[model samples]
Target: MAKIYLDPGHGGTDPGAVANGLQEKVLTLKIALKTRDILNRDYEGHSIRMSRTSDTTRSLSQRTNDANSWGADYFVSIHINAGGGTGYEDYIYNGSVSNNTITYRDKLHAEVMKQVDFRNRGKKRANFHVLRQSSMPAVLTENGFIDTTADANKLKSDAYLDRIALGHANGIAQALGLKRKSGSGGSGKQGYVEVITPSLWTYNTANWDDKAVIVNEGEVFTVARDKFKVGNGHMYQLKSGLYITASTQYVRYYTK
Candidate 1:
């Protein structure tokens, strides 16, 4: 199993950045914890570790040392931005441009921008302590500007944080080249499909009337083909065992 380290920047006494009643430490921990859940649930073999699982102060050395000593494959630092910018961005060490960290950051930045409706601040590079000290390919993400009213408004919503966490998890999954295969009962196998439309509806049966959800937008869920619905124009089963339209209007399934 590939080892992964997650660092939620600042906690307890540190508190990192704060603005508009949002503290960076709390937000980072929430995102990091959620990312761990997603990684464990979706990607099977990788082991995940967090620098601080609770609201406690942890030194930068301890964070890097733990990961280095354990031989983590990737190090991800989660934090919120300050100053004035109103969007999301990520960072790597100064000389990491030629390595896989850039690939991870690119996928991460693209995935977040695709779902969160945030302005693209672009992936960046800096001499941050976590990035420079970690032995593995490391990435530091500036989720959003806590100081910006618009960004802070989104940060205040748990729904927004869920999407942000999923986006970051998607980046980590892609960076690790993890496979999430869906077992199609009859017509071979099909992988996951991400929701792309503004809203998608789900139902209990292929032609049944009971609605499973009001609307699912910008969410990625597991899917497998229903052999019974093959004649009904290829209906797919969701993770919840509910049914939804698999058209391009709602989902996009990528190959390789």
Candidate 2:
């Protein structure tokens, strides 16, 4: 499991950057909290620590020291960009630090850019205090331009922020080689396949066979086969795969 340190830039008396009614401190905190949630809930087993859980002020040195002292594998400082330009960008210190920093920063930039849909301001070298002083691999992300009305509006939405969180999680996952769990899929010798369409049914065979049992559409069952169809009328065939199903009435995609 990877240990991550998340720093939501600026708090308390300092709001970092502000424009279009969006405070950098507030936006940074929101994204940081959501990023922590995505890592803890979806990644599982990984550990995440935030620099500040609330609107408390901490200096850059204090934040970096905390992360280094805690033995964090990676450090991320989240901030909003301002001063005219719009879009996403990331920063790292000049010269080589460690392979981990380079790898993590590359993945982080890719993930955030994918979700933000802002100009790819590209990654550059900077002597930011957070990156310069941190013992672990660290990167500071400037999510978007608060000064731009278009970027500000995009940052205002919960869905947009969620995507940013997702990107952060994805970057961390990539760095740690963590595979994302498919919503309805599982893998193991004892894994089961769920039929969520038509009238719920489960098959327990390595392959979908004619003798697969028909449990209630909503019912969960262990499957022996990797492939099968859920209901009679549903044309969709579930390819051989593992699934995590729930206990409830199965909702058929089509009524027979």
Q: Candidates' lDDT values, in order? A: 0.77, 0.72
Q: Please write out the lDDT profile of model 1 over residues 96-201, one tens digit for every residue.
A: 4446877877887776654465666887889989999988899999888999998898788775676678778777877888665354121123445667777877
Query: Roughly what TM-score does model 2 have, to 2 decimal places?
Result: 0.71
Q: Write the per-residue lDDT of candidate 2 for residues 108-138, one digit (tens) a residue.
A: 8877755555667898889899999999899
Clash-forming residue pairs, model 1: none
**Per-candidate TM vs. native?**
0.71, 0.71
Name the top TM-score candidate.
Answer: 1
| Ten residues in sequence with the least summed lDDT for candidate 2 | 247-256
Q: How far is candidate 2 from the true structure (C-alpha RMSD, Å)?
A: 10.8
Alpha-carbon shift of residue 84 in model 1 (angstroms):
1.5
lDDT of 1 at 83: 92
